[model samples]
Target: MTDISLEETIRSFNNTGYPFPEDKTIHSLFEEQVERTPHHIAAMFRGASLTYRELNEKANSLAYLLREKGVRPDVIVGILLERSLEMIVGIFAILKAGGAYLPISPAYPVQRVQHLLRESAAPILLTQTQLISRFSIDPDEAEVIPIDLNGPVYTYPTLNLQPVNSPHDLVYVIYTSGSTGKPKGVGVEHYSLVNRLNWMQRKYPISLTDTILQKTPYFFDVSVWEMFWWSIVGARVSFLIPGGERFPQAIIETVQTHSVTVMHFVPSMMSVFLEYLRNSQSDIQRMSTLRQVFASGEKLTVANVRAFYDVLFIQNKTQLANLYGPTEATVDVTYYDCPMDDSLLHTIDKIPIGKPIDNTQMYILGENGELLPVGETGELYIGGVGVARGYLNNPQLTSERFILFNPQGLFLQKPPLDPAKTPDNNPPLTESFKGVQGGVFQKAHLLYKTGDLARWLDNGNIEYLGRQDFQVKIHGLRIELGEIESVLSRHPLVRDCAVIVKQFSQNITLIVGYIVPKAENVSSGELKEYLKNLLPEYMVPNMFVIMENFPLTPSGKVDRNALPDPSGLFGTKK
Candidate 1:
């Protein structure tokens, strides 16, 4: 935007309204699907399965009890359970009772669990009796309600109780990784979650026969869509056993046995799965039944894109989509479809996380809230029906992340809403952004500052460049770890890789590359020589550490914090 005149660049989004169901609740849409396919198998875990009618009735029975316990709109109910039929039932029951369900993993440390519970201030916890020992719960903390403990639940009437909940009420408050403290609770409203799910259904519509594998843990936001996306479309859900999400062989067998059509992955785990496909012929053939493979949570590498075609995608029409978003802006806001042709991949080495979802507005803005031009890297800001209300119980932190801004390109267009009719206490626009004529926005609208660095491509797609906070400054040179990792992942011998900065001495910081070799290990000198030809000398890692595997989080993301110390490792320092 370097002092460029606003009149020169084309101003888009002049008309940004869609025919989305503005008033429908998530369960309301699911009810419609239930009417369409009541006899269809709605969920499957192990040998047990539930039809649409049976699931709704069971959820309604539990919902009756939740409402009796004073569950209402915006009420957070703690849910801790392993992957089972009851887990899905509890989620629906909480939502049907007009309460926002908060997921707590059974594998979480007791201290972290206590912290989340304390921060959330939940009054009720849904869990199994056997798992009650896992939580170090104080008597006054939360009233534990095990699904099986209530023997009369099946005898209770199975009817959809009319809840006093509106679309603006909170449906789920998911926790995400945060700095300065423990994980932050991102409270997403029913409207935001419904819009993302509806838009996804429209773009990539799932059929009644399609089976979506629910492998992602409920703690992460990606599981939000994985759980509900199919429920609305009347698609069957095949639940993966607890902790089996990281195993590629297990995924293949699940897909083959259940005829799973749709699934998702974080790019790190996707890379691992694709390599496993290449090594085994039976696994690759079994994975051929997949209709779609979704990648998100981290940057999708070019190598991962190419490997999809070489193995799993060669025999089938399974489309691979890349999704990008944070917990604050719902599960996902931007999506990309990987092209199948080699000629298409030749022109673009980096695949773009293509355009905003329906009725959503995405802007790449520079410092001071001014809009950055194409090809210039800047912070990504999301504004639309998809943006969440704000962080729960953290006003100062929420205000810092969610902001009001008037982009240079959109300043001339009509505001999303009326300025005089608004009633919020947020400050009225008083200042103008630089290099714009009257860049003040009279109307107050909230936008989530993702803190993610991205740039707009020539085709109106966005190229995600990692997190702004994750960028490391070494010797006055700011470096993007994703760029280094992307280049390192391109090497022929590397199976999977990650680049992290380690501080050893007061003045000495080293860039460390941790890699899982394909078959045989390669020496550090050879890897350094390969990186030298592709990357700048400063961007190359100071040391390369070969490893058997990269440790992953419960949600299947590479846990960089758990990487072992690189001291005394085999490598050369520049």
Candidate 2:
């Protein structure tokens, strides 16, 4: 029987809840850090560096300017800018002015951008002068704030109002690509951000002398942690451009040029990086400063992890780690410090995503909500301070997932306060529902149903199996198959689409999309380019297989299994 309350567990684990710090908001943290370390370099992108003092003044200037135009907290302000210091400042400015920042990647389609703007009801949008024409929005219908980092600016706000709340306030909302349907906004509060950053700082201890590569897009949750973390400690943040088709090379050049000591990448990006490394004919040791490499957004395969350790980190001893968590869980819940063991190489099909950080608790349970014995597989449930406050404006989805949890074991409570009421506590349920006859009492358990399947090993480490539904994790990002189909359905060349995850190797999962073209002559390469403009490079299907029609299941839904295997078109690993 678990004795810990959810609230108690969070407190003990040092998880920060919303509305924290009592007096400061997310913007205030940036402002305070900037003021204290004015001369330090805060951001670096393509040979450009902005000092703390400069970043603060620029952000404040934009904030003042935006507020003058009636922008305020709770207002959704869209940001569609390239990865640069100005983009960083634009985000801070929005937050400082009490508005939530909504980042729309230019890589997405104009219609997709417009759809997000409409869904968010964002009244104001900040854009780069170069990409203004990409938006399908009418400027007259909304407030458009244009910032030419190299050009002139008219107004900069000078307000010094004390922030109304603390770090627990809503910091931003990042819309993830929905495989099940349209993109859903993931709300991350200031409290969760602070807690995550604090945990990272303590664990990695990145400092002013350290240089970290900000490879992920600013809109990605990983980027949020990356930008602020380096700023807080006076370290340097090197932003990479949206590499388009040349993403692998972009990552390589950044690491080589910046002498980046720390970096984060999704598995897809990492695979590309490794592929580039193998083909470049350059000395592997050229990546010397990369002291640590972390991969998430998909399962870290044994082969991939082993290759990285052998080829990239062999000479450098760069510590490689696998991080796992959901967006609703604030970036990461658990981590596995990868080991360089040749004997266990083949056994690396699934890496233990380590234990919960600080105050998080994870459970592996059987189908009926009972803890499975060691070496048994079951659904995984996580309870921690890292859990988000459910999805934004998604109450029904939230209710279904975030359920009421009682940790004192199951009970059939009798009528209120009856003196003779029997104790409500029921017998502690085991894997087989066998009542404990003589064992000592254990922590009372309150179970949460995670749709994921996992197994507890003899070593007490849990190994993730796979999803119980059609949900897929591509390059570490959760995607719903149905969501991809919805997006493809709207494409000009696509009449219909069926997306599936093809496991080519134990470590490699590819999103192979089969499309029924509106025009039979539509080429795969052409459709691929079309998608690049609408989705992130990672979400774009690796193999686009055109089909005449989708096979139907007996139940009338698209028969996913009946679709021809894509490995024939795209070569498999063994």
Candidate 3:
């Protein structure tokens, strides 16, 4: 670890270049847009468009109904519905009512949905008439409001209602995959969401003329921006019809028909879509209206970048950018716009995840919590305004992940809290501020420890290596699976690949490679030789399995857990 002073470390990590509004909430920002352009189309779904005025009225009606059922600030309301107009209404209503919305996808297993509902301890659940029957919950446990059936019956004022939420109040709780079997809910506050939107407006401003495609599920954190960010800037948000999320043709047609100016995709889905365009010889000219494409949720490979440049950017002036952030950070913390140069893309092994966004700070820290110097790999710790309020209903895990560090001297004067304004049954806010390096000032800000491993580059960009736990030990030599996968991805015949450690017995373990070949009749022998020439003998996978396609998680990420075990055919390592 570098022997940098505490004050120096604070200066190094703080990204104060871009400014963000501290007093605004997501609801307040959207209301301003609604007031500015109430007649403008806010969102479109299946040939039907909802104007800002209509959307606000629908949300206001539901918000009034929710308030009648005792929903208020910090309260978690469950929202179980598919992608539709009602889904968007449910989200806005929850925020307007000053309650955090807990999104549960109706497609999720009954048990998983029930677990999330119970875990959130939501007082009310908003769903459509069809999904209301899918959930098996007692009436006394939580109030179920069917938006399609019962919402229109109740007459509530559709006029603009002032949101009764503080900046620090909870806005939403999104659950992410946990190391353990259960998913952990991350509670994001209005301040963080507002900061993110404000930064986006300054960096990549969207206008009413721009139409953003909303394909991501509501349960995912990215959907937060997809649903509300456009509304803040008076832009139109176009939704993908049900069953069209994974279909490339459907996505392309929607973009062409709706003239979508902005869209986002995970690298895995982007690769598939690019391949569809290449193979089908689709009319890429139709998508000339697209202005930007954002890739995140997984590592964006160089090949995928090249594919976008050659297939998409070459024909049109669409900007392809790589965004990096976990669910803990409100959507994205950093972004890198890919330059249209093949030689430059070929030279670099991985695209940089870029510098911190407005008001967000990124620090590469060693295992012992010491900040590492540039060019050295360490655990990535995120600090600043985007840090969430911590995990919901899991204080122990929250404390373990969210650390306290006050680099700035803002906490010197403590502010008074109003007991009546605070949530009645919510967990008490805990103060765990320890002085920085035993300094006189004892104030500390919360920083989230992202278990991801990364290194600061000479150009000030951060190169994400992989997860710390993703490192696997084989034959007494620890190996980073990402390093091997990165090398394999460069192979001309390999379209996509993933590396995993398979255990056949207590004493026998083997590193296996799963590959999606680009050409027919490609054998494991060719790939083995290709890897051996570039990697050490031990680094090479013990076996290679050619896969037609890798299974994907609900979030469109490569699902390692769903990978089939090859132990049955390959017995053990020779």
Candidate 4:
């Protein structure tokens, strides 16, 4: 079917990764930027602004207060806040205090928030006064600190705190939906973030005058680079008001007002944003200042690429880079800078998720663990410095997903690490993150088995197909169907349920919940409201199907293929 061989594909896709200084912390690098440009505006929200010096001093004040509260390296401190100056201040404060800040969005359901707090073993939580009352916090379980830093915070010294976190120490823990019907925390260490940030800075060099629009929610790992990237190079970051990301006009206005040069969008949102611009004549002209637009979280489709060019790229010299990776692999691993030329549409059909960034390796492996040749679809295994420490407090799940690959044979049958060789007492936290440096782990590298299907194209770029499992990406959210089904089945009137994604033409993807009710009747409205209390709004099915009985296969498994197509039968959210 294809001319390219296995050897050529492997050599082309995998980058010659270099070693990064493994002993550095994320904040230490940020501190250097502060000394260089202390008075430059670091972040802007609404009309309020903070210079590098002011932001640093405020973060330092909170850091001192947090340190006194026993926050230290590897300690998980919860931060639940709406988008504001305090939200930015709180994130830096947690890092400066030598703690991994777990980003908990204010939009999260109370039950979901409670689960994260409990599962993470969080000791201290930082939140605004408006958000603190939403959660019923136990003093013994976790101490809650309302993030109003005016009263006593200013009394503490504004000097930078001495570094304590090691390269191995976790900088953040992002909770993603788990296939096992629960949310699992993925702890990313400092070195991994440093590698990701370094690659971003070098590959896409933005000037000090360039302003980056920070709109993605902090709960997602995409926001990690958005929050910290500008600080390193002294670039300005423009933050949107809470929930402002949903408004296209606001985003365009912000870009035009700030001259925002860099920003990111989920592929679905890109379509929505482009669609908005297509309909609006004036708004499209206002978005001319955008330099590099990033597309991630979902598949970068042909339509998305076309929409980008039709809306802005053709008129302005804006570049749309399709970035691909899982949250497990620090934000993004591969990037394809879309050809700025107008002729790209006629020549190229689907955009390829480009080659691995610096210090990263992408391998396409067959079912039997053989190296997949060019054009052959296989599971994508990512390795290198960007790989995070496995899920926090989830050894079994960590062992299942993160494994050492054997290029010679089948994958290592057992867990990647030996108990005796593990330096950390916690086995899950001891993944060989630094092993991939300079390809030392050619025999066995610590790689995250991204369940997404992909293949190596002729010229070295990787083409993402779709998920190999139950996980689906909707509006840039990586959702586990099992997690949704688990929550749906828990309803008092629901007997059993199956969650699936329904896709039609023009990228109309919707979450569909097929339920067999326990009671005589359970209204769709009732089910929706109940699920909204337990799961995030996006996880809730856009439509509900009341099935008398689910069609099953010979083995008594729910035959998803036999499930009715609800396209015309029901109208629901897109």
Clash number by candidate, in order: 0, 25, 1, 0
**Cα deviation of 528, candidate 2, in Å:** 7.1
> Which candidate leads the pack in TM-score?
4
lDDT of each: 0.78, 0.69, 0.78, 0.83
| TM-score preference between candidates 1 and 4, better one | 4
Give candidate 4 misplaced runs (Cα > 4 Å): 1-9, 19-21, 149-152, 407-444, 504-507, 567-574
Candidate 2 lDDT, 357-389, residue by residue in tens? 643566676677665555577788765445565
- lDDT string for model 1 (1-574, tens) is 4444432341352133343455778888887888899999999987789999889999988988888989988899999998888888899999999999999878766666777778988888888877988777886888888885244465557888896788788899887645432457899988788879878887888888899999988877888888998898889999998778868867887888888999998776777677778888777778776989888877777777888877767767678999988788888888889987766666667978877776567888888767787788999988766778888899998989887655534533322333444335222322221222454532125678988899877667889887767666554233668777777788889999988999897446789999998867687788898876545466679998889998999999889999999896646778
What TM-score does candidate 4 reach?
Answer: 0.91
The residue ranges of model 2 lying beyond 4 angstroms of the native Cα positions read 1-24, 157-161, 244-249, 275-283, 341-349, 407-450, 458-460, 487-497, 503-557, 566-574
Off by over 4 Å in 1: 1-16, 149-153, 407-444, 471-574
Top of the candidates by lDDT: 4
Candidate 3: tens digits of C-alpha lDDT, residues 453-560: 998886668898877777554532336687778878989999999989987864367889999999978899999988765555666899999999999999987899
lDDT score, candidate 1, position 443: 19
Q: Which stretches of candidate 3 lie over 4 Å from their true place?
A: 1-13, 149-154, 280-282, 406-444, 470-574
**Clash-forming residue pairs, model 3:** 405-445
Judge candidate 4 at residue 53 and give its lDDT: 92
The TM-score between candidate 2 and the true structure equals 0.80
lDDT digits (tens) for residues 1-574 of candidate 4:
3434455547555644544444568888789999999999999988888999999999998999899989999999999988888888899999999999999978888888888999998998899888787888888888988876554455678999988888778899999998777898999988888878877887899868989888999999999888988988899999987887988978988898888999999888888888878987788779888889988988787778887887888777688898998889888899988876667676778888889887678888899967788889999998776777889998988878888655443222212333444355223322343332433543236789999899888888889888888998888898999999988888989987888998875657899999899976898899999999988888989889889999999999899988898876755669
